[model samples]
Target chain A: MRIFVHTTYNHRDYLKRLYAKIVDVLKDSGVMVITNHDHEGKEDLTKSEIERMSDAGENVLDKMDGIIIEASVQDSEVGYLLAYAIAQKKPILYLYEKHSGAKSVMGYFTNSKIPDSVKIQVYEEPDLPAILSDFLHRIETGESKDLPTIKFTLRITPQIERFLKLKAKQYRTTKADYLRDKVIKKYMEGDEK
Target chain B: MAKSRSKIALLFFGGSGIQTGDGRIFEVTKKEEITAWLKELPELGILADIEPVFVFGGPASEVTPALWSALAKKIGELYPSVDGVVVTHGIDTIVYTGAMLSFMLHNLGKPVVLTTSPLAKEMQSPADSEGLVSDYRNLGVRANLINALQVATMNLGEVVIMHGNRVMRANQTIKSIGPGQNFFEPIGEGLLGKVDFGIKLFGHVRERGKGKLKVDAALDDHVCTMRIQPASHAEQIARMIASGCRALMLRSYSTLPYPQSFIPYLRLAQEKGIPVVCHNLFALKSTRANEEYILINDMTYEAALTKCMWVLGKTREREEFRKLLYRDVAGERIKANV
Candidate 1:
């Protein structure tokens, strides 16, 4: 599978590290992989030359099978391609670094409305490997799953329990499934529950 | 017999234990001490004739369901005629808790002041639990108009109300970062500003939509950001594209009026069917992409846009999230297009 990757230059050092890890993770998934790193003519090119390089990048996107992005860059350069993918409603996998005080890079997203076409995953340094593995597994298996199963022991009130039960029935799903799904979905979505 | 004082709901969430006027901070958080503290309020002429409704979250519990249920119940019970709500909580998730109340009770006519202290309630700070009660009482009368749309972070020395998705924290008199190097200097702009009370609750509350106001306990997730560089390889874009990401926020370089080179990713995203959000550029100018294909990230980080996107990710009408993304609120023209 061909995957178009976008990253800021600041994270270039970690790029190779993440890329190598990704290849290792997907090696046995029976998916033939093509990467953004495989493209040509990306050296210190001039202005017009850079345009051609963009054209080259577009050509790769034209042929690639999937798209992945490292979207921690506050000021992103591939706005054209990024905008294009959004306009096309492509299935994008977004990853970011976990920090105690996260300094958001994308002022646009931070300042504006989030589009519907994006799938977001947040991972810490220690857990990137596992998170990436899960993502790859889902892509390979075609599983539409929810994640980050953190167990929150709630001190339930009778009325609250009744509310949950009613909600479960209203949704036409089992109470266990409803609560579990709601918790997982809320966690993944970062709801203010 | 004459009717008792108006039911001034004073929900206290401390511990399951019952208290006297204890000097210990941790000790006062007990049920007895919390109840005593609450009981003292009506006598002090602060809540004057108002009944105190104390709701504890257990001594160790930060914000359990009991706490939320109490809050939600109070809101449901009061609706339009609520006088106000006083939330006393530990400093751990106080700000987040405040934000949740602000969003969940979007159309709230009454004020819900969320207060906390690094020092214990028993500690000898200028603004102890008693002082906090004084502040809330004063706030009820003085704060005739408040930005109800978003949470207002109020401390002992400061009462910062977020306006235009921007949170300004300072003393009651000041609004900007003054000469004193205060820690709460203005940061990023807030997405949603103070909600207007005069505006009918129906349009604003219903328009904001219904969902859970889950206080995120853990935010230790990674957000790998990258800028598209010149001579950037599509192969690089391809790897990044297929690497299985959570979400991608593609920003155009502010320097460039038109970033034509990056157009290929649009075609790639179209084929991939991923949600790629564009920032800092006009959506109409983004000619290569379609509306369904492109999403506009147009709010401040402090705004609910990020939270909204995360919420919309779970719904069956995930596609409709795009439509809801750029709706106007708090007198701001929130558009998905740049």
Candidate 2:
């Protein structure tokens, strides 16, 4: 099973343990670690490596079966990456390091109004591996993807359709294309889902 | 009466916002204290001509089976006269009251709104505190009362909890825990509707039955509830089996079976023909374990517990018991997969 793990790029010291912990947790699972960072303490990854990581991350996520995100440190790029994963319909399991005010941020990923909002869980360092293992198993067993995507048509006003057309043309995109992009971007940015 | 005017039955049980001689230093009969409190809210008459009927006094936890029965009877008797009924209850066990009424009252096509507040500073403190000085208008809690009354008038036609500025089906909502924050959250979905400007309905309101309202005050409160934990004591369950009640709502961990020790007691209960409903676990479909022994509590714990009381009043027959558990009574159960 291929699983993509995303974390904050801003925190070099934090990822020192986070990367190692994730590696330790996912050790025996045989799931491919997309973000294979050489976290030998604070020199987390090179500047060129970080640049290379984004494209690699996107590519890995494309081929991966599931995603495990460490949201101990909030980052905008991480949010966008998580949102991108949701837009792709990839089942995700978000991990939050147990902190006093963890519940506040945990709800965004867990109890999201977003249709693809993943299961957000709180864990101490020791429980990370077990939680990841259970999450991966759920993905393997199709428990995480309990509800399959279904297509349906929604009737809208001519004016609304015209507005969409105008906006889509202005944005140099199709109405259908822009709608999905705008909604996903808005949902990920916490503007609306 | 104006075209918009609604005859709302305001049944007061001395919850927050109602002085009930608690927010002030005085002594009076329960009925008089409630009536006096109503007189203080003369402006409330502008919203809806609320016919204040005093049910009980004290915190919501003081509500008993007799009280619920009496309140149910009152709502039934007044159902014909009023456009709807707004129940003023304490927040402590308000959801339980809501669940009880959802089962106890049938064919209720009028809104049965339950509303309450945190024990406001005025209600908690005496004359010495600064709260009493500012609480002359009952603070904004009385405004919340009027909001509930307004909701009762909206033809909502459902048992709803009007708290945290949102109205949700009584049977589907559970009380959120926090200080001065008692929000009723719907089990699976979002709120039924928001109680904000213009009374926007969320289209979640169920269609009312096309028949006369039926009242079944026969609730067997002998039913009790227990949440299953990793180290659950089977002896306590055995003791409960020996003498506690006729039925039990066992809140399981993910609707799974109890510990091995609890199996014998559960088997014993099953043997004695008692209905031990394992509740509060979400099960859109029955699993193998569910079929073998465990009963999935697909409904909110509050609803499941109250439904147990309601069902126990009907029958102990295994077939009937199973039927009612899975039945869509008041839209409580999550829709089973087709």
Off by over 4 Å in 2: A1-193, B1-4, B18-29, B120-139, B178-182, B207-210, B283-294, B336-338
Residue range B138-184, candidate 2, lDDT tens digits: 22354456557667766567788876446678887887653222345
> Quick one: best TM-score, which candidate?
2
Question: Each model's DockQ?
Answer: 0.01, 0.01
List TM-score per model, in order.
0.33, 0.58
lDDT of 2: 0.63
**Which residue window of length 10 is worst by lDDT in model 1 chain B?**
B141-150
Per-residue lDDT of B80 in model 2: 83
Over A1-193, each residue of candidate 1 has an lDDT whose tens digit, in order, gives: 5455554445455645665666555445545454434252223224574354232211224333345565544222233234334333344566666542334222323214444445566556567667656656554454432222344676989998898899775543456656655555436645643
lDDT of 2 at A45: 33
